[model samples]
Target: MGGFFSKLGLSCGIFCALVARFPLSAQTKQAQNPVIFADVPDLSMIRVGGNYYMSSTTMHMSPGVPIMKSTDLVNWRLVSYAYDTLASNDAMNLANGQSTYGRGSWASSLRFHNGTYYVSTFAQTSGRTHIYFTKNIEKGPWKAVSFKPSYHDHSLFFDDDGRVYLVYGGGKLRLVELTADASGVKPGTTEQVLIENAGAPAGPNTGLPAEGSQLFKIKGKYYLFNIVWPKGGMRTVVVHRADKLTGPYEGRVALQDLGVAQGGLIDTPDGQWYSYLFRDFGAVGRIPYLVPVTWADGWPVLGTGGKVPETLALPASKGLIPGLVASDDFSRRPGAPALPLVWQWNHNPDNALWSLTNRKGYLRLKTGRVDTSFVLARNTLTQRTIGPTCSGATALDVSQLKDGDFAGLALLQKRYGLVGVKRTKDTKSIVMVSAESEKPVEIQRVPLTQNKIYFKAECDFTDRKDVAVFFYSLDGKAWQKIGAPLKMAYTLPHFMGYRFGLFNYASKNAGGYADFDYFTISEQISKE
Candidate 1:
């Protein structure tokens, strides 16, 4: 037995060393490079002084615009939200127990100029683009500016000569030079620079439809990085350059068929340039991908394929920035916040709705209005799906729930698949799972000895078909399984990845709250 153990240990060490010494391919290198944000789509990034700030499209989820801050181009933390409320009631009317993952915010832009941070969003349902500006990026006193730019995936860029321009519209690219005051478009500045009907071979689906336009000037040449949506296919990133800010620019392919391209240009101090792209992982929504840009013969070659590289040599190690950490301890440690980088709200959030106080050692979420749709409603605590094969666990104390009050942990993929635990007056507590059109299937119902409860849900993405497992605990140890594994698939129409977090709903008449503590996630590995 000792010989066997020693051999096994040696094998493991050899495997680890092999993995550590393996040379990353050019494609793998690009994919493994650390990015400040992950899984966030339609990114617009800007450099302010020495810090970098970024924002991405937040579909129906409230606290609409998520703002992140980082010193290096790699590590990022959620700093604040651009909008606190959904601003529209249509989002609140989604069918009860439905998932709305891929339908809300599309591509957005974040820019800093003249002591203000400007953000623009395309609300698909509204079909109108809106822009907001704030003097401070961290603590916003934001003001909304209205412009009926009937388009999606908009971006703003300021030229070297201090000229502002808006690039947007789909199927074609539009550029409108803005006046010096940044109030409106300059006279005769509107022009359609590139049309999808022009050059470029038709993809297996369809050729790229221009979108997500960001203008930049390098070496006196104007470059526009545009997001292209192939007909009936995934998103691609393409670039066009011109000698003049407004002109007949030449278009070249940057990234093709990698995923949806969002976010704009992000550069390191060492003069290395990378564009943050997004990949749609259904239920996981859109996650961030980094593509390194190198100029060759005066044209940009993204990744290494003249197309998006799936992998590449990792960024130079000297000035390397660490990737975002997925674990959370909830210790709060004086200055730490409770939420992680993946968490987002539909609208702006009020600090009073949450806290880490007393000896609770848990997240306390007060019950708010119970609206069927999460898109327009407030008081939802949610996070993005980080890994393909992972499990999330959280302990909840629901002793305070009233008759119609329910608090539980959920694995949500929009209005699609959901598995959770809820407390009721008659049942005490029950474990349930449901999908977009499927009925709420009860997995287990158990009477509670104490009002407080501990709950957990594990999502196993190891299998081709993702499986979700639910469990509950009374003392935070001895856990009991609630049901057979619930199977899920990413190929389902509108289905996305699973998001794990806590939520609560109160009857209009019942005033209640749900407290959650000790949330943790683990990566699954092969078992002997």
Candidate 2:
């Protein structure tokens, strides 16, 4: 009901009284910056009723365009995806050495119209613009329709007169009116350039111009927010305001701290305004940050004193379980999703290859093709590895694995690492492989004697000094450290964070499958 300081003061009061009974843990309840510490980039968010809903880009991953819900804008949980799969081309299917690793879907725009929740995004790989609408946002049977000619970094705006408009484009901004149903642009209604160079002083830079346009109409004035990277400076925020929808507009730099720019404004029910933007923080990918906004001279100014605050309004932290991150047991009910919302495929998944009910209480991953590398392996399940440190462990039932099948836990990227079981025609062994700079390197290997081998990958992204270490267990209680450390990276080639992935690929043969009993993630400090 109050700010973080007030909540902390109250907790301290209760702590003093309970000191004689129990000891308080060391983790603090302070709300920190980079509200979400994972790779939730190109964010588009909206507030509905009592909840804040956010949509983010997941690129080539199946079940793309993740929609997360948060009550306090800091503690977000994945709710649904706009599409189960992009399903447009072979690249989306990871076929023929072609993959949509970094080019499927990018920044999304989320909005609530009347009673339906709408999420719109364009995929560069698909060359299409998709519009999804649902009456229920959380659990949705979203009706989807797509059209040719993709719109880049666009915002979906519903005008007061019930007209639909798409505010999109590069430095020379354009607004195209849509049909009454919002299915497509009105025929013969040519686009209008809304703003020129967004009124920049040095004009738009050719290398990194003004893009990611989000439009808003507040209190009879039209506002456009965009991220502009000047030729020699850091990422900047430019806000253009016009009294009419088609402007005649003037603009200014609104917020520009720590490269946190390119997002629109949202006001709470109680009238508190905040800007939800993201910052590029090295190999962990672009992390989202929420900045408080204040109205000055009828214009929204971002950040306090033009500086990013370390601690903002604190929301209740429920420690990333059953919410942002989950430890799956692979048990499905009568009519639930085959996998939890927290899990996504590395690219488009082979729907028939993995199952939860195939073997009760276990996840069965069957290989459909013979692939030499993990990057080309389809159906490698993945989830974001949160910072400062977390360990992802899985109990692998390798008794049924075929020869040439590699099953284990992975920290997946263009350059990645894995601690998994490699089964041959007659033998099984545990091994570690990593890719630091050029390509994947075999760091270490250990011969295994048991069928149920446990693999764990501990990732540390604290302060962006990203690194990962591998471990293995035979009894599930005693752990042995193995493999050389991995320098986790956020490379633009992959355009994603280091994710804890469950990968099983075939090399020498196909039809080899592995059953994973469970995957567990917990906070841990590296023994190093």
Candidate 3:
């Protein structure tokens, strides 16, 4: 027995030595800054056992609040969504000349309790607060409950005593109690002010007052996190702590670097803490950043030495491409979904007008109704455009297009750019449209003779230099630049980052259709 044990110990030592000598890439763990270099913002994260789940704001996009899952804090993948359609209305449906472009859903708060998961968000367009709950987080038929009075930038908290509450509001923070089931406000519970001057921690002259509230109870104390932008200053993080849920709280400035604010706290299984926040990175929009957290005399300290670090001790990210945003061949096997979770419609889509099985291995977008412009067009499929730089290409078949049909690839935003085949009564022409101002203008138009063509849009967001260019190809290998360059701007109307979209719309007729063979994405721009 002693000889056998000695041999086992010697083998273990040899294995350790070999592992040290080899040092596999998976064993090398060091994460870089801006953990996810994509436009995933307004984050609310929760850790269950060894897995972490996050819910973020997607504004007017259908399947509104996106839920992402990650085992390590660095890499994440989309798991599910909170709701399919926020509401069946004119604006949400993009009908009657009204659109919910930037006003559907705002910040969301996610929590889990008693084996039930809850995600709450408020929409200014709907003018209400929506709370969705389910037993299964990944595959869920979530049930919803809505109430009047939209809560802005709220946090859903479940107390130890089985009471539920919502801490929310703007410069002057407020609190309200919910029913035990969290369906609505608790009876006889009056809404009251929690902190009179929540933005005072950052300074008195505040421009964007203290908002984006996230509340937590850690070790018998209630801590509230918020973001504030003082006059002539950048976005800052402020924390307010109290001995009780309702009390005279003490406030202080937590993190004031790189405009990386507006998120809450999360901890790992190994007991390390982090603050998941975001920064405004030009046209790519708000990208997530993780700052290490340490407790100092019971207050959580954010960042290292008052600054966001360039790297972290967590595992290295495997990248977001093909996971968060993927190239779709529109091919599926038996009993498979027609569209993947990475794709989202601009708004509530007209499902009957778009299909994958219409033509095998092709996404056929058939026009259901005639519309005036691209923004008003229904059933526009989209994917978030990622950063430093990225490009999306698609092979379009305009053979089935009818007169007055416009179908192609585009970078969809308030100020947009697109390259597509436009059909008229007598001829077919390839046109490039740019909406840098109040109205869209045809920047360039070239007559086309082929039935099939490829279109691509490349976006450059390096160092906040937001620019995009369009290109077209006849043979799919060689590409030609077309149209004026798009000076991409993060406008208030969109309230989100630019997205690669496949759009088909008709101006004079409604029976036209466009077939897309494949959509591909690369992290490199063509000019690079």
Candidate 4:
């Protein structure tokens, strides 16, 4: 058999060689700007040895504060998350009318000090500043520490003198010292106003104030990075420098093009510096951008010729698919994770309501209670929707769905759009619902005859033309457009980008369930 296969030129070594060559060609020698084209915003990055680690905000998404790892800074993959559930509350549980839709944990600061990895974030819903620490970041069983009064867009910094501090606030930045273990604020240390009018450097006319403070100590000088928005202008990068950890600090406007601001810095192993920031790119959310940095007369100048470049000297992108966001077949072997790292719940999930073991090769989401709207539905497994265009396709097994159960795929935002199977007492309908207005309006409904259904949500964020359309099919091969185009907008209420989600919730009765066979994501949108 081996000799016959060799004669046909189908040897195992030949097949393995072809597979190895594909991945190598996927990553180019030079990197591209907007390093990641997903909703990875408010980035805080750190370099430990040759590896670069980053953390980003995912407000209201449980398994919050996603930690990502990269070797060349362009190609990254999700490693772990800081917490499984941020807080256990009525809002987090999707109970009552209260929902932490846009008000969960905000920005996070990731740091490594003395062999311990630390990530800190603040939550308005929980009203606390949370600090999580682990000896191992990749495989973390992190321990949590909480304190009252959450800080806004704070940076956790470890000074050279062994003192830890948190620099935070908006417009006017403030500072507070943390204890040795970073449990709480140091005993007698009062919150001091660090930079009074931190936004002043940008100009007198300001729309969005300076916030998202990330401080770094480079070459014995303290450098502070913040984002400021000038009136009638875009999001801008402002930097401050101080000889001491505390003021008096001098400020300057760094990079203002393309509204790409609000992140910190990371250095390469070979001594090259880069500014890590994000741009608010419509409904696709705030995508990350990498700007080359150079020191000019003691100041770190951002971008090339004072503009964000489209490409860089670093390694090229290996793409975000199967890394930042991926397709899941819901099949897992023993000892493997129930869901991939790319997936996150809409909010704190009810562990008892979801399982991969209840049925082999399927994700079973049982409705524990009734939800009035799709936004309040629990157990909605989600991943970031990427740009310039992408589509999320799912095969749902609705044979077990009870009356009043709704199960399908959704493009989740404040004003969301969904294509799913909605069952009533007498009939099952394939419905397309758009919540572009105040209430969810069922745009179209077709009678669903079969138990198994295929649903897809295609999003186009090209040139900031944010639009999404829903499609449904009895067979996975052929699709029919179902609804009015969803005019995707970046609303402040959600505070995050749109996510492709698999959801099942009850409108009237509980205990109804839906099984998802698989969720597949494609970088290209398919035409019906």
Task: Pick the TM-score winner.
Answer: 3
TM-score for predicted model 1 compared with the true structure:
0.77
Candidate 1: tens digits of C-alpha lDDT, residues 1-528: 999999999999997787778744422323243242224666778777678788866666666778877775555777777776545544433434443445555567787777778887766555556677888888888777555554556667777778887777765666666676555557777566554432242344545566667767778987778766677666677677889766777776677755646445667766778777777654444566677788788887777665555543344322111122254545666666556545655334445666668445777777555644333334556665555555667776677776666567776653333334455665565555555344445555666767666776766553234666677778878877775666654533333345665676665433567777666766552232
**Alpha-carbon deviation at 470 in model 4, angstroms:** 1.2
Please, what are the lDDT tens digits per residue for candidate 2 over residues 20-88?
466443334657787877788888889887899999989988889999998877788999999998775
How well is each residue in 370-478 modelled by candidate 3, as lDDT tens digits?
Answer: 9999999999999999988899999989998989999999898999999999999868888999998848999999999999999999999988888999999998999
Could you estimate the TM-score for every candidate? 0.77, 0.93, 0.96, 0.94
lDDT of 4: 0.91
- Candidate 4, residues 1-528: lDDT per residue as tens digits? 988977667666776797788765455467877889889988989999988999999989988899999998988999999999999999887878779988899999999999999999999999999999999999999999999889888999999889999999999899999999999999999888999998998999999899999999999999999999999999999999999988799999999899999987789988999999999899999999999999999999999999999989887887898779988888897899988999999988999999999998999999998888889888999999999999999998898788899999999998899899999987899999999994789999999788999999899999998999898888899889998999998899998899999999998989989999999998899654
Q: Which candidate order results from sorting by TM-score in descending order?
A: 3, 4, 2, 1
- Candidate 2: give the clashing pairs: 283-490
Shift of residue 466 alpha carbon in model 4, Å: 1.1
lDDT of each: 0.61, 0.85, 0.93, 0.91
Compare the candidates by lDDT and give the number of the best one.
3
Candidate 3 versus the native: TM-score?
0.96
lDDT score of model 2? 0.85
Query: Which regions of candidate 4 fall more than 4 Å away from where they truly are?
Result: 1-29
